[model samples]
Every structure is written in C-alpha cells, then in structure tokens.
Target: MARLPRLSVTDLPHLVLWQGHNRHAVFADDDDRQAFLALLTDAAAREGVELHAYALLDVSLWLLVTPRRVGALPRLMQGVGRTYVRRFNQRHGRTGTLWEGRYRATVLAPQELLAALVFLDHQPVRAGLASAPEDWAWSSHRHYAGAASLRALHAPAAWWGLGDTPFAREAAYRQRVHDGLPPEHERRLHEAAVKGWPLGDAQFLAALEAQTGRRARPARPGRPRKGGSKSVPKLS
Candidate 1:
C-alpha cells in the first residue's frame, strides 16, 4: 500500500520517533551523541522548530517539537538527518543509511502536551537504560528537572504554566514525571505515533480535519448501511 503524507500542521506540538536501520545502534559513544545533539539544535533553529523535549536511546530517538510553519518540521528533520548521517559515517568508517525509514510522528492537542512530555522523559527508564529520568544524560529531562540548562530548548506554555518560577516549575515537572503515565496512556501514545494518527478528543480531531483537510483519526469500520443517516463518524 502507498504511504500517507505526514500529517503536519503548523503551531501544534508533535511527537516524533526515528529509529536506526535494523535496530542497530545509532550513537556509538558520548561524542557521537553530542554531535547529533549539536546538529539537531542547529537544524531546529534554522527551520524555526521549537524543541520542547527529547530522548536519545541507543537505537532510536524521540522528540517533542512544535513547528512555526507548515514545512518547518520536515525541513528540520531532513537537515539534521542528512548532516548527522554524513558525519557519523565519516567518524565511524562505515557507510549506508542510518535511519530505518521515514520518521513516525503524530500531532498532539493542547491537553496532551504534559502527558507527552512525561512520556518522552520516561523513555530511558522504560527501556532499562536508566534507573530514573534524571540519570539519562542525553535527554532534555535534566534540563526540565532543573539539574541542567540547555539554551536551545524552548519550554512550551503548558510547562511554563506549571508554576510562577523556574524552580517551582522544575519541581512540579519532576514530581509529575515521578507520578508517571498510566499504562493505557503510554500504550495509546505509542500506537498513535507508530500509526501516524493525531491524538486528541473528538472536538480536537474535528477541528484539525477542518483546518487541514485531512483525516486526523481512523475512519469508522464497515461500509455505510443502506438508508442510514449521512452523519460524520465519531473518533473511537
């Protein structure tokens, strides 16, 4: 079957995931990870994409970002991917594609932002790479948790609304992460990203479809029954 074009809308937060080819390691060492992050920071700035949260696992990376314009997200990803692949190949003395394929992404509603952030932060822990989110050195967790500051990261409104001061916000965010996502919430997030479907309630999905002229959620099962009311289907 033919693939659908990525459902990218301007001014919306998106959860993006890209994995290595054949599940191979993408970052061989600390230097490789640092280089990839530098490339990402530069590309995001040039493409006008706001980086809100990120996690770098050995075989895959997840990013939560908001693009300022229609094509900003793709441009940023392409720039970072191409440049990083070249540099990595040179440094490692290997050749061939690094990524598995096109990256997977799903647009998010305002209500889902904080949950997405927590999900991204907990990726390392879920993968058994860290005892806690704070132990992951390559992710934006440290920055959000008040242990470090990354100038390139832009905190979204949801994060800022956590508290009146930086310390307060950080503390609140840390506690939220500690609380963690429900198993069902985590499963839904993973399913949405992998399937490239927008994650939201019915109203949000309707608004998104009206604005973008594309389906934001799956269509209802089965063909329309004869003489049935011609109403739009609700998102399940």
Candidate 2:
C-alpha cells in the first residue's frame, strides 16, 4: 500500500525521527555531529522552521520543530538530508543512502509541547548512551538548561510559561526533565511519530481534521457494524 503523506500543519509543533540506514551509526564522532548541526541550522533557517529541541543519537536523531508555513518541514529535512549525505560520504569514504528511509513525524497539540520536549531530551538516556540528559552534549538539554547557547534554537510559548525569568524557566525545564515522562506517555509519543498520527485529544483532533480535511487519528479496530459506532480507538 502507498504511504500517507506526512501530517504537517503550519505553526504547530512536530516530533520528528530520522534513523541511519540499517541502524548504522550516523554520527561517527563529534565532528560529524557538529557538521550535521551546522547543516541543520542552515536548512531550518532557509525553510523557516523553528527548532525547539533535538537529540542526535549515534544511529538516529530526534527533533521538535514548528514550521512557519506549509511544506516547510519536508523542505528543511530534504535540504539537510541531501547535503549532509554528500558531505558525510566524502568524510567517511562511503556511499549510497545514509538514512533508513523517509523521516517519521507527527503533529502535536500545544498542550503536548512540553511533554514532547522532555521526550526529546531523554532519548539519549533512554538509549543507554548517557546517565543523564545533560550529559548528552548533542541534544537541546544543555540549551534549555542554560549550559549552552544554540543560535538556531527557539523556545516555544509553553517554555516561556514555565517561569517569568530566564533562570526560572531553565530551572523549571531542568526539573521537568529530571522528573521524567511516564512510560505510557513516551510510548504514545513514539507510536504517534512512527505512524504519522496527530497527538491530541478528541476536540483537538477534530479541529485538526477540519483544518487538514483528513483523519487526525486512527480508525477503530474491528469492522463496523450494520449501524455505525460512535467509539474510536484510543491511541495506544
């Protein structure tokens, strides 16, 4: 079956995941990671995408972004992927596709923004690459924690709502990451991105459906009866 187009809406936060081909290491060293970030900074700027949070794992990378207009997300990803692949090939003395396939992405409601950010920050830790989020130098954790300044990074409105002062906000964000997300919530976020489903409640999904003219959530399991049922499958 043909795949559904990536669900992207302007001005909404999106969680994206891109993996290396066959689970190989995408970033061989700090230099490769730095190069990828530089390329990402350029592509995101050119495509008008606002970077919220990110984690660059050895075999995969996660990103939280908000596109300023329609088609901005894919354009940004495509531009970075193409250029990065060329440079990585030359640097590593290898060839062919660098990515597993197309990137996976899911649109998120405003309410889920902070949760998604936490999710991105904890990826390296969850993967056993680091003991703490802050130890992962390639992620946005340090930026949010005020340990580093990334020029391309943009804090979402929810982040601002964390506290009135910069230090307060940073402390609050650090605390949130320290608290960690529930396993179920993390699973939901991962599944949503992999399936390209919109992550939100009924009202939010309904509004998104109206805006996009497509199903915002998955259809119910089992066949429909003679009379239609009002129930929809809950996101697992």
The sequence of per-residue lDDT tens digits that candidate 2 reaches over residues 2-74 is: 7777888999999999999999999999999999999998888888999998999999999999999889999
After aligning candidate 1 to the native by TM-score, how far in Å is the CA of 195 from where it should be? 0.7
How well does candidate 2 match the true structure in TM-score terms?
Answer: 0.94
Q: What TM-score would candidate 1 get against the native?
A: 0.94
Tell me the whole-model lDDT of each prediction, alpha carbons only.
0.92, 0.92
Clashes in candidate 2: how many?
0
What's the residue-level lDDT of 230 in candidate 1?
73
